[model samples]
Target: MTAGFALSPTALGDGFRIESFTEVGSTNQVALERAGQGDPGKIWLVTGHQTGGRGRRGRPWDGRPGNLAATLLLRPKVELATAASLGFVAALGLRDALQAVMPSRSVSIVPDGGDLRGGGRFALKWPNDVLADGAKVSGILLETAQGGRDGLAVAIGIGVNVVDHPRDTPYPATDLSAMGAGCSASDLFFALSDAFVDNLRLWQDGRGMSAVRDKWLQGATGLGSQIAVDLGGRIVRGVFETIDSDCHLVVRGQDGEETRIAAGDVHFGAVASARNFKAEAR
Candidate 1:
C-alpha cells in the first residue's frame, strides 16, 4: 500500500481490492499488465505519483503529487461495444464522487439560450471529462486488453486534480482546491470507488444504458447549443443535439442533417459558435 493512503471501507466492501503504490509509471499500465498475467480483476491499482499517465489519443496526463491516479481492472462478460459503454458509466461515477467530496454549492442551470455560469457547478463533458466551474477538473480513459480469464480485461483509468491543475491546455482546467473544495486524493478515491459500484450496477452491462444516458444528459454541457467536434482529419460543427441510446454523440448540422459521431474532442459555447461562424463566412 502507498504510505499514508488507504481505501475507505465502502470501497473494499463489494469484492473490490486495491494495490497501492508510492509511485508508478501509470496505474492503467500496471492494471493491464496484471490482467495479462491472469489476475482475476475487481482490483484497483492506485499511486501517489504517475510519471507516464495518458489521456485520450495518447496525450500525456499530468499527475501532480497530491492528485489522484487510479485504474480499476475488470473482466465483464459482454461484447466489446457493450464494455465500451462503461466509459460513460465511469464519467457518471466520477461526477458523483466529486459532488460527494465538494462543499454544497447551488448549481444554476441557464435557460435554453443562455450561457452556463461557472458557480462551482460540476458538469460532465462528453465523452470523458468532468468540469468544475466550466473548466476540466478530471478525465477518464478506458483501455481493453485480451488476455484475462474471460478473454478480455478493461482498465478504467481516472485522474482528478485535487490540489493542482495544468495550465497549458487547449481547454480550461481547474482543481478542487481552486474551486474552494478542500478535498484530498484519498478522500476522492474512496468516494469514486463507491460511486463506481453504484453506477456500474445501474449500467448493468449496457442493459441500463438508457437510464445512464438520461442521467448523463441531465448534467451534460453544451446540449442544444452550437459545438464543434474535432474528428482528427476534419471538424464537425453543429448543434449539440443528444447522445443516442448507444451513447454516440448526435450532432445536427446547419443543413438539418443529423450525424452520430463515435468519438472526438468537443468545443462548446462561444468558442464553438465563433468557430462555426468563421467557417461559414469562409
Candidate 2:
C-alpha cells in the first residue's frame, strides 16, 4: 500500500483537514463517526483501499490501489433538501479536478464550451457520476446524519478509477491510467480538495444552486437526446430535458408529457439500448 497522503499547508485552506489511511472499510462511515463525535466540520477521510466501500443503492464500490476513496465531512448550515444538492457540487468539483490534471496531449471526447477549458472528454451523468470517453470514470455518494454541535452533517463520498475499472459493470467503465492520464491518488485528492473548496464557495452553502445547475448542464451528457431512468419500482424513458429549479431531472416523453424524476439511475445512448432502457446499480 502507498503511504498516507501528505498534507500541504493550504491544501484545503483554513478550517479544513485531511486524514488519510493506508486502508479502511469506508471513508464515509469513518467520517460520519467523526462527525458524531463532535469533530468540527471540514474533515476529509481518505483511504487508498476500501474493504467495505459502497455505491448508490448499497452496491459495492471498488477502490483499486491507485484509485481514490475519500469523503468530505461537512456541517453546513442548511436544510436536508439543500444539503442533498452537494452531490452535484461533488460532481462539478471532480470534473474540475480532472480537467486540471488532464494531460496536455489528451483529446477530450466532448467539445469545449462555456467555462470549461480542457478537452471535453469529461461529462457529468445525471444524479452523481462522471464519464470520460463515454465510460464511467468516477462516482459520488452523499450520506447525512444528525451531527454533534452542528444540527446536520453530510458525508460526500467520492470514488474515482485511476488505475483500473470494473469490466462487469452495466455501463462501460474506464480508468485514467487506461486513458493515458495516469495519476497518483494523493495527487488527485489534492486537486479534488482544492477544486471542491472553490466550487463550495460558488455554491454559497447551496444558495447559489442556479449557478451550479447552469455549470453542471454545460458538461451534461445526452441533453436533448433519449434517456431512461430507473426509479427502482418503475422505469421512465424519454427525451433528456433539463434539471429543474429543485434539481429534479425533467424528461419529456414522445407524447410531450413531462416527468420529473426525484431519484433514479439514468442511462442514455448505447448504454440505455444495451440495458433495454433499465439500470440495476452497475
- What C-alpha lDDT values do all the predictions have? 0.82, 0.80
Clashes by residue pair, model 2: 109-121, 110-120
Q: Which residue pairs show collisions in model 1?
A: none
Number of the top-ranking candidate, with TM-score as the measure: 1
C-alpha lDDT of residue 186 in model 1 = 82
- Give the per-residue lDDT digits (tens) of candidate 1, residues 1-282: 224556667667778989888889999999999998889889999876788999999989999888899999999888888999999999989888898998445564422223653323787777878777677888899999887345889999999988889998756788898888876888888888889999988998779999999988888877777877778757788988889998999999999999999998777665566645344322
* Quality of model 2 by C-alpha lDDT: 0.80
- Model 2 over residues 17-104: C-alpha lDDT tens digits? 8889988999999988988888777988887787789999898998877688989999989999999999999999999988888733
lDDT of 2 at 221: 72
Query: Using alpha carbons, what is the TM-score of model 1?
Result: 0.91
Model 2: lowest-lDDT 10 consecutive positions: 110-119
